[model samples]
Target: MQIIVVGIGGVGGYFGGRLALTDHRVEFVARGTHGKAIRENGLEVKSIDGDFRAFPYKVHETLDTIDAPDLVLVCTKSWQLEEVAQQLAGRIKSNTLVLPLQNGVESVEKLTGHLDPGQVLGGLCKVISKIDGPGIIDHFAFHPQVIFGEVNGERTERAIALEGVFRSAGIDVILSDDIQLAVWRKFLFICMISGMGAITRQEIGVMRADEHIRALMETSGKEILELAKHKGVGLTEKDLENAFRAIDAQKYHSTASVQRDLMAGRPSELHDFNGYVVREAEKYGVEVPVNAFIYYCLRPMEAKSRAHE
Candidate 1:
């Protein structure tokens, strides 16, 4: 299989490294220092699953350098998805599958706006990881899993084939029948965690342990659930329970990539998480005070960081 991973950050580097382990041709698309490092030293992944060095078939900074791929993983941050999709629009073949391992629920919509709708898949991943440094991905927590499916819930041959490829690389992959719920469930977890972690500047273990912060997290989650309901996304109380379960299971020092970025004064996915929820809540006439408070409180830092970028 000819695969293109568009962003060699945490999600891309680790999973793309796993895919590169196969005999298939997995080309990476990274930029700046990270791209240069990979071209010079190959991609090293420090994973709880296992550590390995992956030399992809090639490392190209831009998609135009590459031809059509059997699969394209848009592993960029939530904010970069639309730009990545636009770049991919011209390169992908008719049969190419474009799967976004992004954090938010709007990825399929964003990709479909730029690429072939049939080619876009609704997807989300479970992994606590980030770039430890240039060319290095540290998968320090959680058992990584990739859950994806066709946007309309069809059991397509291509989806099955792609699932097989992940399984071949020992990734815990799933072909979901209801990908919207899956995406929403994952969003519910990450949005609450990222917002709480960013606002409080605390780790998941700490926040989950503190009664007041735990209440904040729960209220924020409830707001998101109401917003999801207003938007016609099926998110249940059990899904909320699962989200809290994940928080409980996280490593003591685990913090989301968005939280880390906000803390470090770097550009982050604030708009993709709480900001998105707040906007959508306004649109749908749903009250999301907790999410709005989180977004408004942290948005100034986000703007400053982006201005620096």
Candidate 2:
């Protein structure tokens, strides 16, 4: 398959690097110093699973220079999704698959608004990783995995084919029958901790250890659960329990990418994570006061970061 990994950050770098090891043709879309470094010295992945490198590989800064791909793995930040999707408008074939490995649940909705709905897939990933340096990705925690499927829940041939390819690359992948539910389950966990982490400027361990913070986190999660219920997503109480368990299972020093981005004053997924919840809650007439408080508290910083960007 001719694959285009659009954004060689942690998720894309690790998974795309593994896919490049296969016989399929793989190209990466990166920008600025990172793209320059990858084109100059190749892409490097420092992973807990194993270390590997993909040199002499194709790297492009824009879609204009690349061919229409059979598969496009979008790893851009949530706020960048619409812009990226617009760029991909005429850059993919009719049957091309676009899977967004972002944290939020609205990726498919956002993409469909820009491109053909048939081209977009519901997807999310589990991993704690980052760009340690230009052209270098660090997978620091979690057993990396991806879950994706058709929006309509059909077990199509394309989904099966992608699953086979991912498996062949030694990737832990789940082809879900209900991809939206999977996305929300992950969202419930991420939304619960990410906003709180950003507000507190602390790691998961620190937040979980504080009674006040823990209570706030639980309330934020329940707010999300209420919103999900209104949206008709199949998120359950058991899913919320599992989400908390997942948070507890993380490394003490573990922090979400959103929190780190906010601390560094970089643009983050704040609008998509907590901000999205707040907006949806208002739309559905659901009360999400905790989520609203966290989002409002961080809105100024988020706006400042985006302004500079």
Candidate 3:
């Protein structure tokens, strides 16, 4: 399969580099120093599993050099969706399948505005990773899973074909039947962990260890579940329990990526995570105090980020 990874950052870089190293025809789309490094020195991934470098692959800043790929992985940050849509509008063929490995629900719709709905798929990537430097992806986790499904919720040939490609490349892929619910449940988990961790500047281990923070996490999760119910997303009691159970099982060692980004003074998915909950809460006439508080508190940090810039 000819794959084009549209963002060579943490999630994209690590997965794309791994596929390329496995001798798949992977093209990485990057920019600035990272793009230059991949073009010159190759793409490198440093992970707990081990480290590997892939030098025999293509890297470019744009799609101008490549033809329409069979599959396009939209791995860019949620904020970059608009520009990515515009770029992909001309690059992707009608048959091209675009899988958005973005955080929020809005990405699929946003990209659908630019492409056919049949061509866009929902994808969620579970990994603790980030870019350490140019051409280098720093991953801290061993278990990396990519969950995805067709938008229409059927077992389509495109979905299966893509799954086959990913599986051949040695990836843990789950073809979900209820991807929307899966997305929301994942969002609930992220909102709880990211909001609390960003607000308190604490890791999951620290947060769970503290009784106060643990309660906050649980409350924030409940708020999300409530909001999901209000929105008629069809979330189940099992969904709520399963999410909490996963958190409990993790022993709180699993931290939010947003928390790590905020601590490092990097850009976070704050708006998409906590801010999304607050916005949706207002729409449903639901009060999400914990999420609202986290949104307001970390908002000022955006200014801090600008000042540094």
Q: Per-residue lDDT of 178-243 in model 1, one digit per residue for the tens?
A: 999999998899988998898888888999999999988898898888888888888878888999
Off by over 4 Å in 1: none
Clashing pairs in 2: none
Candidate 2, residues 1-309: lDDT per residue as tens digits?
999999899889889888888888899999999999999988899999889988625999887887988999999888888999999998889999999999998999989999999989899999888999999999999999999999999999999999998998889999999999999999999999999999999999999999999999999988888898899997888988898899899999999988999899999999999999999999999999999999999999999998998
- Judging by lDDT, tell me the better candidate of 1 and 2: 2
- Pairwise lDDT winner, candidates 1 and 3: 1
Q: 2 or 3: which has the higher TM-score? A: 2
lDDT of 2: 0.92
Question: Lowest-scoring 10 consecutive residues by lDDT in candidate 3?
Answer: 246-255
Off by over 4 Å in 3: 63-65, 249-254, 303-309
> Candidate 3 residues 160-246, lDDT tens each?
888988887677899988788878877876777786888888667787778988888888888888888887787776776777776
**Which of the numbered candidates is closest to the native, going by highest lDDT?**
2
**Candidate 3 at residue 288, lDDT?**
90
Q: List residue ranges in candidate 2 displaced over 4 A.
A: none
